[model samples]
Target: MAANKLYIGRKVRDLRQANRATQAQFAERLGISVSYLNQIENNQRPVSAGVLVALAEKFRIDLAELSGGEGDRLVSALSETLTDTLFDGYTPSLQELKLVTQNAPGFAHALIAAHRAYRHNSEQLASINDTLGRSLAAAETTPYEEVRDFFHFVDNYIGDLDMLAEALAAEIGIGDADPGPVLSGYLERHYGVRVARATQNDDLVRAYDPEARLLTLNPYLPAPTRHFQIALQIAQLHAEAVVDSVAAGAGFRTTEAYEICRIGLHNYFAGALLLPYRRFMAAAREVRHDLDLLAARFGASLEQVCHRLSTLQRPGQKGVPIFFARIDRAGNITKRHSATRLQFARFGAACPLWNAHQAFESPGRITRQLAETPDGARYLCLSMQVSRGGRGFRQPQQHYALALGCEVSYAENFIYADDMDLTNASAYDPIGISCRICERTQCASRAVPPLKGRLVIEHNMRRTIPYSIRPAGDAPQS
Candidate 1:
């Protein structure tokens, strides 16, 4: 199969930064003019075959990627939108696409907006056609989505609250020792609250009685979880003003969104308290981001470690830009944050081909995936099943898999990805955000075709997939 013209600006930029070569030096090595290199890095030009061979020979990059960078989000959306099979066999070249994005950005945005609206309207129409006089209301964003977007816009880091948590953690001397007792003592001394253990019969994980000045914790929770709960309580009580101010500044539309955002801020404070930025970052660098080692050294759970890793965007002393996600047995995404370019689907379960789905099959073992998305960006995903909050065999436990991944550009920073063959393009399992927005035309496990994709049907020619997707005016693939 012939490859289409790929816009791999981000990958090229990453490779150049990884090698620490100036543009002039890199251009000299690639045998291209500095201006041409700049255009390629900025995604204004398509890569030539000679340049591809130079990237392969000099940089060991197989030149497999699509357009991505810190450019306009509309460009990314428009690029993904154009992948619909309705476009027929004609694909705009990289230069032409760039021209559209640059010259008529509003037009590009209008096209993408139309595509998204079409998908939503199509769903509503299907529901309406199924029943007589059934009017489907206009879709509205949920409070959960509002809060998630709030966090996303903030880079999932509350600088003031994080600093406060770190300072309080230092004051309480949170080291390798048990933090539960220290945090409990701080609450007692400062707030005049009594910390006691809740009986096994108690259903609440934590209960605070203001009239009696008592804080009770369930005995069943693990030590790390107990400490986390204590830290969260402290964040609510001590950092109330800061968290409130941050939540207020986010200006969430709904009251429920504001409240949820407040809770999320408390979570950030709690995690920061458990793992101070500088201390945890030093340890993470020392261990090369080994999750187990970091967890043991910091007395944190694996899920907590993954969450903390995603928020390592501490301006100057930053760690690898990692993406973290958790999913239940039903494949519902419980938590997701991406400091990288890979975006999770806004609705529905993740793509089935993602590695997190298989993490449950092997309980304790770490599952790794060299996966590529429809945009041609690649990631190194690591996942493992985690269980928490169960009292007895009959009692229900919260079971989920936590996945930590970053682009292969930063793979060398992770110890788990040491043995991964980054140079092998065929090793990657093709995946997507979701089937509706996915651009793949030949996927055997595609739940549904691209939203507006045209399909070719034949009764006699059956293949791995029942129907093949093609451009509307193009002949069917044989």
Candidate 2:
């Protein structure tokens, strides 16, 4: 085969396995000998044009699937992983990466998994110190982080669970209005579980007595919170099978992780039940994804509506691909989910230049920012403050900034991006994953030096940043 000839043995093997056909069966269907098929599948020979046509005709496989999407994604992910400081900047050539992706995809995936595990351990150690890592290298990942990684890999979308929640919503006659009343009625009539409000002494946001068939919610809790708690209870009581089904293959590190994942799934179902996908997507389009309007229409809080918007990635009926995160006053990410290519840092705070931190200062108002990542991806980010706990003077309000953002490609669909100059590079703030990992030295907000570069401290001279950093191999500055 010529170098330019197409070799999609991996894709061919995938299609054959998908159809559950042996090499002989597949070869016969394609009107080819088993030996020739074997050669093609093993990349010993290029797939002929005739074989491509035969494949489309027999298996109805889209030729586009064979055009290296998964390979490209694998290459990109592998490249990103290898560029981490842990790999010492030893990035493989693009051609080498392509070979790994196409010829040894399973091994490539294993490498990615090991890299993720390594990154997880590094993050855990960063929180404490390297001393803990030296002795207890085996037990590096925590339960919360393990579950978070599972969701992160899945793009925070559970297809079957989403569908199940949508179906339950429809079956219960819940629509683009308050789901609380309907959910309460359904619980009482079907499960004989009566919903009630708890007094101050209850000191719980939500409590359910299964034996008594009672669900007690904090009376002072926000309406959306109350409804969410009710729906979560419904998920735990009725949708355990679906939750367990999703949890079974999640590869959780501990029982706590498994249970926490179930809660997360139930919370997902609750959100789906409250803001049903079809109606929410339609309303979001009508309003151009205005968070306040969507909140009012769906009877959800700004945070709830924003969080729900990120999970609208159904197979055919997808909405704007977005990332949603919640951060506290101290910059701790309380909740994070993203359907976009941009991923949150597994440990440490987000980039200081990101607008999410400013949301705390401007409470009850939406802060809009045009931000670009180190990878050159731009996003239209919206952030607003969310407050919890207001029962008494002693109960101080817990403030969190909820950030909702989408890639700049979808900026036209967002009301927040209306007046921003999306084309101008200067309009966007340069943000990165974290200070320790970020390579941008020009940032005045950088608290520490980057992990990849060698720091050069000048005793007599000081730039805007404390120290100058250059790539490891670069000659010393004159």
What is the TM-score (0 to 1) of candidate 1?
A: 0.76
| Model 2 RMSD, rounded to 1 decimal | 5.1
Over 4 Å off in model 1, which ranges?
1-139, 472-478
| TM-score per model over all chains | 0.76, 0.82
| Angstrom error at residue 350, model 1 | 1.9
Please list the residue runs of candidate 2 whose C-alpha ends up more than 4 Å from where it truly belongs after superposition. Answer: 1-86, 92-139
Candidate 1 lDDT tens digits, 119-151: 666667777756556644443445776687567
Model 2, residue pairs in steric clash: none
Model 1 global lDDT (CA atoms, 0 to 1): 0.79
| Highest TM-score against the true fold, candidate | 2
Q: lDDT of model 2 at residue 256?
A: 87
Which 10 residues in a row give candidate 2 its minimum summed lDDT? Answer: 64-73
| Whole-model Cα lDDT of every candidate shown, in order | 0.79, 0.81
